[model samples]
Target: CIILQIIPSFGLPAGLFLVLLIGIDRLLSVYFPIFYKFKNVRRYLMYHGLAIICYALLQYSFAYVYFEDRNVICGPPEIYQGKAKALWGSLSFTVIILSVILYYAVWRKLKNTPSMANDHRLFRSILAIMGVLILGWLLTITMFVLVVFLLDWRGLFSNIHLQSL
Candidate 1:
């Protein structure tokens, strides 16, 4: 139970952060090919370091909150439950929107390139990959929304019961 709660706190944020990085990388390569090509190792290392810091912060915060109660089956106490879902949902939506924008930019760029103009295979592959990624994120966002709604509904009912007592 403890492990389950701890893993997602770090894992989901890191995974979403990687998606954002990929989108940014794709946009950079597309719009500023020369700059992307000329980017030094230090710049790349700095981006990686930032990602690490974000992951560490998420992990420590979640662990600190959940560690005080060993009986928590799968998440923080009721008071903190909906917050995680909301946070993940927002992140997923942001990633989805960024991916859409980046994919559209790549498509437009590819369409205008003489060499890639007739290459249906490359376009098809890119579209397929993007479709998969978008679908996955959409699924995650849907689940998070549902969980948050359900948790809130349950909390409301529990509160009513407490008032009655």
Candidate 2:
């Protein structure tokens, strides 16, 4: 049960970071095609793999803050609240915003470069996937912010009134 709870806490931020990584990969490929192509594959993989490991460790620290109390019910409504939720939300929001900027830059670069016409399909697919992810996160964060502001935290989490409705 604890592992199940930890899975989402670990996965959500990691997944968001992965999307941002993809954006970075696209941005570099578009802006520095020669450098990107000639870079050693093993070195790049090693760097990115190390980055993932470091990021996971950082997120694990944040998760420690959130899970410090060990609530009886391990769901979001029970576990996520106040400062911990706000911190995670802000981090996720920042990643999404950065991703949008990166992808937009990539799109513009791709559009202006007639020489790279053949790569449009690949860029389009990445753009599409990121678009869906961005929208989903926006909606989720919007609702979370609304819920946080519109109702008292206790009412939303503890009272059981929301479940009735």
Candidate 3:
């Protein structure tokens, strides 16, 4: 359970951050083509990469301190339950909202412009990627909320194990 919880706790945020970085990169390429071409992309990428790493580390540290427990169970203690739920819920919402906003801005920017076939294809691909990300994360968030708030986990786990056979 600790391994399961820890992996997603680090991965979800990092994935969202990577999406945001991609959006920013696309915006830069579209709006500042010359500067974007001349800029040291590696430096910018390194900085953003480091920031994402730091953010993941911080999240992992929080989970380690407040959520992980080997003595009782491989999950958060009862005292930290609310905090853990709130933390993940808020992070999910934040990612969803930001992705929507970024996608909207990109769509609006490209709507009036006459673009080459390649550009249009790229735009469509980006839109699809964002759509998939939002859907997947939304489903994950819903499950987390349902499991944490709406259902009894003891029974849920039992039913899941029974059905797996």
Candidate 4:
């Protein structure tokens, strides 16, 4: 029950980090080739480290999210019921959607560039994962929403439900 919080706590940020990484990398490759080519390895590593920290913050944010004062479920479904569903929901999926669009754009643009080489493959893989993530989240959200509404309709969800992220 309590462990279910781990899904949004860590999942949102982890997904965001990947989305940001691939999105930013694709943008750099297409519009800032020179800078991308000459980027410092140390800076690159630091950037990734920063991404990691961002993920951590997002994960821990759940700790402070609103939890329902009372609830009913086999597990803690109401743990993050109404903190701010729209914000976190948008944040999680927006990154995924953007990643998909950005990767495809970069890939099409770089298709003919000889320099694309192994990097193209990287983008290809990113694109694939973006698809997977997008699909996974979409399906999960759809089911969760269906359940939420079902509970709400049937008067299963408690009034005390709350969450911020």
Candidate 5:
């Protein structure tokens, strides 16, 4: 119970960072046609690496400055918490949406360009990675959400019993 309260002090930010990174990657793929055109795969990777570091910094800042305290409490403001929650929920779902779009787009293009057989191998790898990423995140979200809800339910039940007594 106690840890649950403290966890989002770190977890939400980390998760958000990942969500953001994935979002950026998708954005680049969709909108930035020249994204990998420089022939410098290393630079592409470096930029991606920078995005990750940016996420880490922002995540830590959000956790420490907004959520954490010395008293080991875990909570967000009644109103603002909703906003924060919405941001994450929305971001995650958007990623899922983009995943669907990407899958379809890739499939469609590959189907149209049958001569690019080697490209299919690359597509398979990308799909596999994306699938794994999605599953991992879903599991993580489910675990955290369930834990939080159950703890809250227990707390609520305890309070109810105390009041009844």
Candidate 6:
């Protein structure tokens, strides 16, 4: 159970970093086509992987501090609280925002190119996928904010127990 909970602490940021990297790749391909064409993508991908691992480890360290004696099997009530949760949410939000900006820039550049008309369908599909992803993250962020500000952590468990009975 602990492993299940801890894995996401590492995986979540790693996944977000990958999305950010994808956005960066798209931005570069569109904004600097000549440079991007000859770039060593394999090397850049390796660098991206390393950077993701480092960031995930850093995120996991923050989680480890609050994980001393917490019971994670119950739900996010134990995992998503305090400074660690705040820091994670903020970092994830920043990544999402940056991705949105990068993708938008790519879209604008592609739209302005008269010869790239055939790529619109592909770009639209990508936009739809990204839209859903961003919406899910927005919902998650809202849930965290509500849990932190509106819900009383102690009372929450009691209410769940009462309702279950």
Which candidate, 1 or 4, would have the higher TM-score against the true structure? 1
lDDT of 2 at 96: 79
Number of the top-ranking candidate, with lDDT as the measure: 6
TM-score per candidate: 0.64, 0.78, 0.71, 0.62, 0.51, 0.78
Better of 3 and 6 by lDDT: 6
- What would the TM-score be for candidate 4 when compared with the true structure? 0.62
List model 4 lDDT by residue over 22-137, tens digit each: 67777786778899899997989788878867764654555346444554462322344465444455455556566667766776777756764687687678768776776776
Candidate 4, residue 101: how far the Cα is off, in Å: 2.6
Model 2 residue 165 distance off true place after TM-score fit, in angstroms: 15
Q: Arrange candidates, best lDDT first.
A: 6, 2, 3, 1, 4, 5
Residue 134 C-alpha lDDT in model 5: 67
Name the runs in model 6 displaced over 4 angstroms.
Answer: 74-81, 149-165
Tell how far residue 134 is off in model 2, in angstroms: 2.0
Query: Candidate 5: worst 10 consecutive residues by lDDT?
Result: 76-85
Task: Give the TM-score (vs. native) of candidate 3.
Answer: 0.71
lDDT of 5 by residue, 39-107 (tens): 477886687677656654544443334442244324531111423443444444555555556666655
Task: State the weakest 10-residue window (summed lDDT) of model 6.
Answer: 71-80
The superposed Cα distance between candidate 3 and the true structure at residue 117, in angstroms, equals 1.6
Question: Tens digits of per-residue lDDT for model 3 on 21-134?
Answer: 777777777777798899987898898899788877765655656663435444422223446556656665676667677777777778767889899898988888777887
Better of 5 and 6 by lDDT: 6
Assess the local accuracy of residue 58 in candidate 1 as a C-alpha lDDT between 0 and 100. 62
lDDT of the structure predicted as candidate 3: 0.70
Residue-wise C-alpha lDDT for candidate 2, range 1-165, written one tens digit per residue: 235666666666677788888889999998998999999989888887777666655665655666555556666334455566666666666777888899899999988988655578878888998989888987887677666656666555555766777
Task: Write down the TM-score for model 5.
Answer: 0.51
lDDT of each: 0.62, 0.73, 0.70, 0.62, 0.53, 0.74
Model 6, CA-based lDDT: 0.74
